[model samples]
Target: MNGNVTAPLSWVFTLVFVGFYVVAYQHSIHLWRWPYPRYILVALSFGMVLWLLVKMRFHLPWVTYWIEMADYAFLATLMYGYFKIQDKDRRIKDRLFQSANWDALTHVQNYAAYDRAIGYHFSRSLIRHNNLTMAMFDIDHFKCVNDTYGHLAGDEVLKQVSSTVVDVLKAKDEQIVLYRTGGEEFNVIFPGYTVAQAQPLVQEFFDRVKALRIPYNDVELNVTISVGVSSLHRTDHNPLDFYKRVDSHLYRSKKMGRQQITLE
Candidate 1:
């Protein structure tokens, strides 16, 4: 606190401190957040400049005349290293988050994320006495597509089916979220809609899907889906009890006939 801030020796020590802080800051990945690391780097850079300006007014020893420029070069090198680490960390986190939330094939939320979201919304709906509806659907005779057209074609069909469902239902309510629960099966959750209110929209969505005849490699692959709808009841207590009721209707839809909607 009492050193010659204008002295070249003082500038040398200050720059070294900045360098050490940078090393520690960049490596402290789990500890620091945005702007904290950036602020430290900025303050050090500004101090280096102000100290250099003051040192210019004083005569330096011949041996240390070039030391000021060397300090600047060293600081620049450390900053470059910091930037490299920051960029790498951002990319790694992006990939990790995307893989966790999204399905690789359909680009919709995966089962793990879907489970968490539905459970949270289900609890909130019960507490507020709000309408909560679930619809589960599966492609009718999906195995036939894989057997007849090959697995690659089946994968394409699955992606397109999910895409169509999203485009159709997302506009009805932005809060409505859909997920591919597993192969050939998908689930949609409507937070504030009763089962009856969702019927016409879902019927239209299935009709559009039933009308779809995708062409792949000189083969026209036609597909249809069966949907089962259920609403949350006062008796429901947990996610499993809630989901099983919805799943039962899906089984009924498949049983009555393929390519139909069953809401009981």
Candidate 2:
């Protein structure tokens, strides 16, 4: 009687342990990309199955076997439920992050994302002495467009201009990112590039915006942009200092002429 009870109990414990091991292995793979863990699990599972086969010669009662199987089924269901909940949680977090950081109208990074990225990059550049450039630009006569063509037209213009700029940056380099910082205003950050290196790209952006002909209703609308470019300065104390300097240069571009690039 003792041997009969012990045999079934041991099998039950082994199955429970295997169930836990499988759940842990799944979690580890989800968190990290590694192959060694998978191989190890396979080897262990094979060994466990062989050991179970050797123990299978014990003629256990049908009721005890059924009970052990039922226990394993319940445990497996719990593990699967937990894994699904974790996956769902991760997806929800990713979706929320995208909605928060991206502009709905232009489908680019929004001002909040700009604020976070600029600060992080600015600090990193100051520490590592890496090249960083910032460019601030806006539609030259954006208000006039909103007044004459209506807000919907203005929105379409913003969308098309942002798309054009994104395409230009993507062609030049993947590291360059554009942000919609304000109404009709956008900013670009060029990582690993100086003002001189970034100049031609900025000029290309200016020319492209100048050439854009957006159709709204029965009329076609033309747009021009004024840009100000600046690089990290030794005198800058914080990201705000860099931002102010670039903003002042943009003001200069607008003051000097409507459609041109200003750099310092």
Candidate 3:
């Protein structure tokens, strides 16, 4: 009688050990959605078949077989719940990251994102000796618009300008990113592009912004932007110097009169 009880108890203990082993192995591998439902189904079917063979060989009771199956089912349910929670946490992190990095008004990257990207790209460009160009531009007489119309109308103009620039950049190159650095001020980063190559694109942007006619409060308002474009120089020690150079060019454009592109 002891032998009979020991045989069934051993099988029960083995099944429980195997279940935990599989879960631990998957966790060690950092597997996502492991032990999926289909895998669990296959495992359950195989375990049932093996149990049947053992029952025939040892004359084990039906109660032993049912108890082992119940333990396997419980472990599978627990694993499924664990993966579900992980997936939900991943989504929440992604959403929070987006909210922090993107501009709430224009849907483009904000100044904080710009700061991080510029440093990263600048370092990469230095290491790889690749071309990188930056353009800084702002709306001309933007304050006049806000003064004459209203802040609401000024907001609409910003939205329209940002949308137009984003569309243009998307069509031209996927590697280029636009950022709203501040009020009515935007910047673009072009990886692997020289000043000569980026000039036409900047000019196209200038033409597009000049052509924008934003409708607000039953009145149509025309907008113009002054741009300063520059490429990376080997002499430059850091991204700030590169930025200052482009900013000077932009200042020159504004000084020379708005609605033009100044290339450096």
Best by TM-score: 2
lDDT per residue as tens, model 3, 138-161 = 999999999999999899999999
Model 3 alpha-carbon drift over 4 Å, by segment = 1-65
lDDT of candidates 1 onward, in order: 0.82, 0.85, 0.86
Q: Can you write out model 1's per-residue Cα lDDT over 1-264, one digit (the tens) per residue? A: 146677665666667667767765665565456645555565556555545544554655534645765676577667768977998999999999889888999899889888998999889998999998999999999998899889999998998888888988886778888888888889999888999888877887898888888889998888999999999998988988989998999998888886788896
Off by over 4 Å in 1: 1-70
Candidate 2: Cα lDDT at 112: 97
| The 10-residue segment with the lowest total lDDT in model 1 | 54-63
For model 3, state the Cα shift of residue 36 in Å: 15
Q: What lDDT tens digits, residue by residue, belong to model 2 across residues 69-167?
A: 556555655666686689799999999999999998999999999999999999999899999999999998999999998999999999999999999
Give TM-scores for every candidate, taking all chains together and pairing residue i with residue i.
Answer: 0.74, 0.75, 0.73
RMSD of each: 7.8, 8.2, 8.1
